[model samples]
Target: MNEQIHEKLKEIKQSFRLMMNGVASHSMREKWVAYKINWGVPIPDLQKMAAEYGKDYELAIELWKEEIRECQVLATLIMPAEKMDEDLVEVWMERLRTQEMAEMLAFNLLQHLDFAPALAYKWIASDRDMYQLCGYQLLARLFARGMEPNERGINEFLDQAHTTLEGNNLPLKHAAYNCVLSFCELGDEFDVIAQKALADLNIL
Candidate 1:
C-alpha cells in the first residue's frame, strides 16, 4: 500500500479502537457466530466516519483486507461504487464471513454496481449460503431503488425462490422471503405472483 493509504487506514483503525465496546462486541459475536472479530462501533458512527472520510477505493480495499469486522464495514461504507467492478465484487463476496457482512455489503456497495443485477442472478443460483443471502438482499435493494428487471428475470427469480423455500435451509429461506417481499413491493401484478409462490412453497 502507498503511504497515504497506510496513514488513512491507521487513522480509521485508531478511531475504531477508541470507540470499541467490549460488551457490544461480545453480543455481536453471539449474534453473528461466523464473525471472528468485532470492534463494536455502531452503524451510525461508522456511517458518520465514512461520510467524514469520503470515498477512497484504495483505502477501502486495504481496510477490507483486515480481520476486524468493523474494518470491513468501514470498507464497504467508504468504497466508491464507480470504482467497483465484477472482479472486485467477487473478491469481496468471497471474503464475507457472515450474513450481517453480506447484508451490509449489498446495501452499501453491491447494489450500486452496474453489474449488480447480473451478479444477483448468478449468486442467487449459487449453493453457497452467503452468496445466496447477498444476492437476494441485493435484489431487494435494487427493487427499492425502482430498478425493475425484465419479465423473464422476474419469473426466473420467483421460480428460484420457490425452489429455495421448499428446502430446509433457514438462512436461504429468509433470503427467499425477502426476495419475494421485494417483488411484492412492485405492485398488484407482482404481489399476486409473490403470494402464489409463497403459498405454493408453504412459506406463507
Candidate 2:
C-alpha cells in the first residue's frame, strides 16, 4: 500500500512538473495546480486510496513530505477534512506553517466545517507572523460564512485584530483590513456586535 501511494504520488509529481513549465513562478501556480487536480474529483477516491493502505496516517505524512511545494498542496486535498486526525493535522500544519497560509487555511476550513476554536486559538495568539493572520482569517470566515457569530468569539477576535493593526506591520494590517471588510457584509445582527467591538478597540 505504501508502495502504491508512493508510485501514485510519483506520477502526480511527474505530471505536476510537466504542467509547471508554462506556469510563471511569479504567480500562484502551486495553488492553481492543487485546485485544478482536486476539483470535481470524488471524495471517495481519497477514501479508497486511504482504505487500501489501511488508513495509515504515517504513510500519508511520509507521502506529504516526499513532494515539493505543489505536491504537498495537492496532498492536503486527498485527506478528508472531517476525518483528519488531530496529530496528522498538526503534522501537516507544521509543514505549511506560514502565517498567511495558516490564516488562509483557517478561513478555508470554516467554509466547510465548524470552527475548531481550540485549534484556532493557538494560532490567534501566536506571535509568529502568519499564525496571527490565521486568527483574523478564522474570524473573517466566520462572519463571511454567516455562521452565527458567537459574541464572545467576535469580541476575542476583535481584540486580536486591533492588536494586529497597532503593530504597524503592513501584512498584518492588510489582513486585518480585509477581515473587517468581509465582516461588514453581514447584516444587522453581526453589524451591531462589530460596531461595539470596533468602538471598544477605538477602530471606529
Task: Point to the candidate with the largest lDDT.
Answer: 1
Question: Across residues 125-188, which tens digit of lDDT does each residue of candidate 2 receive?
Answer: 7887666666667666766766554677667766777777778877678778677767667777
What's model 1's TM-score?
Answer: 0.94
Could you tell me the lDDT of residue 26 within candidate 2? Answer: 30
Assess each prediction's global lDDT (C-alpha) against the native. Answer: 0.85, 0.57
Model 1, range 64-133, lDDT digits (tens) per residue?
Answer: 9998888999899999999998888878877888888888999999888888899999988898888988
CA displacement after TM-score superposition, residue 167 of candidate 2 (Å):
1.1
List TM-scores for all candidates, in order: 0.94, 0.70
Error of 1 at 104 (Å): 0.7
| Global lDDT of model 2 | 0.57
Which residue pairs does candidate 2 place in steric collision? Answer: 99-130, 99-131, 103-134
Query: lDDT of model 1 at residue 150?
Result: 87
